[model samples]
Target: MQKLRGALIGCGFFAVNQMHAWNDVEGAVIVAICDRDPERLAAVGDQFGIARRYADAAQMFADGGFDFVDIATTVQSHRALVELAAAHKVPAICQKPFARTLSDAKAMVAACRTASIPLMVHENFRWQPPIQAVRKALDAGAIGEPFWGRFSFRSGFDVFSGQPYLAEGERFIIEDLGIHTLDIARYILGDVKSLTARTLRVNPKIKGEDVATILLDHEAGATSIVDVSYATKLGTEPFPETLVELDGTEGTIRLSQGYRLEINNAAGTTVTDVSPKLLSWASRPWHNIQESVFAIQQHWSERLRDGGETSTSGADNLKTFALVEAAYESAASGSPVEIGALL
Candidate 1:
């Protein structure tokens, strides 16, 4: 297997983990790194031991001769950079939200399709060990036939300390943070028939809503209530927790507040913690989607080498982006919106 020489376009806060993950990947190596900020670029380059560095994406793409490019930049720049990668005939693994708008996401997918290059958006929340475990549990019928489920992320994790731009963005949880949760719901459940969402701006300073509650109507007749909040300020260790509770006809499972699950039926009560946990980065209870970098990067490397699509391809992620758009429309119109209409 040929090792894919990689180039990271952004050396911002989260890029650090992606770089580290690339180094850890068996058949991939980050040959080049680029960032507008020299100081941050130098710091990341020095830490990662990469010799090739560029201040611009074009120069990096031209000079590095990378097999694949990692666009870990912001949402606003994803389309242009990803298009640049496609033009360069380099497979791209970009960071999420795939783009600021659904149209931009569609354009990115089309551009990559036109160029015959693989385009993957790094939507890694569902790849996290705990979420993956929940996925496995659901598949194994540990929670029986999942009729309903909730994907909740309530935290005051001070995410702005690193990415301050999120504090000022016009899109809130559903588009930004909740986007991952909504996609997880879709992955665990199925295609959404329609959805009604209400957004709340608890934080006065930010332009977007700090909290949102989404009512999802899946095609399989499962009703899911997805709640996402960046304003949860609990004075406890479990303050910033992701709550996932699913109830089926035969059993029920819950994960949150120290992760307790209970199942009751003729088979007797089965109660235990179903939380899929891993080593925390920086602080405990790592909630950032960035935590799944290793999983996402490994998947990217395998797909890039084996000639397959990523776990979160731009085209596949269209459904996820549609959910975000529908949430916004539903919130604005105070009505349930059809997922297909957004497409």
Candidate 2:
């Protein structure tokens, strides 16, 4: 089978991981790249051996020869870029924090639908090996109808060092990190019915909240908490790990900090190691996320080739993106925000 040709826009910090993953993906290869900064563009193009580089996205789209376009730009450019891809009838994979607002996400989805092009958000947290294992266990009835759960990611690691723009944003943790956790919560426990959130800005140096605790009422009557904090300092920093606790009618599931998965039922308790594979270009702590990037990109390639809908399709991601918007709304109002209303 001929590999699908892909074009990647925005050669930033996270985009490098996407580029590395593209190299690993079986069915796709990035043939072109675009970035506004000539120096960064040249750097990534040189690093990845992608000779086709453009300083403007529009020019790249005009001269496009690729099967799909990966929009790895930041949140602000998401809608415009996705719409541009849709205008060209190119299947697009957008980086997470899908859009600035739920409405913007909805419009992007509509644009793609009208163009008859596939649109996937790079919501890779659900693609992580451990997270997928938890979902698989739930599917196999290991937990027997989960009712209560918690998805927690707390760390003091300096994320701003690599992406200093993180500290400058007025909306921080929830948008940057918690978005993944929230998506995982939805992926495991099902869609949220309502959400109530409280946040704090612990680090004075940052403009946005570093700590956030959110309560979610799942549509299937399950209740879950998504708590994330960049201000947390632990002896053993979990960093990018998302610890999960799931309680069900028959048993429970726990994904601990050390990539340990424990499942307890009436029969017995079983402990297993559910660590993500360290790819050649992936590093510690971030390998889990890096692996998921490859997984999701591969999935996009397969789905685009097979004429099937992607798991994190724009329509589906609107629900997850809604949680982010609702979080801020709830944090400000000190009241529960209805997910249905936001959707």
Best by lDDT: 2
Model 1 agreement with the true structure over 81-190: per-residue lDDT tens digits:
99999888899988989998899999999999999999888888878766776677678777577899898888877777777888888886777788888888888888
lDDT of 2 at 273: 100
Error of 2 at 28 (Å): 0.8
RMSD of each: 2.1, 0.7
Model 1 worst lDDT window (10 residues): 279-288
lDDT of 2 by residue, 1-343 (tens): 9999999999999999999999999989999999999998999999999999999899999998999999999999999999999999999999988998888999999999999999999999999999999999999999798999999999999999999999999999999899999999999999999999999999999999999999999999999999999999999989899999999999999999999999999989999999999999999989999999999999998999899999999999999999999999999999999999877
TM-score between candidate 2 and the true structure: 0.99
TM for candidate 1 is 0.93
Candidate 2 backbone clash number: 0
Model 2: per-residue Cα lDDT at residue 221: 95
Worst 10 residues of 2 by lDDT: 95-104
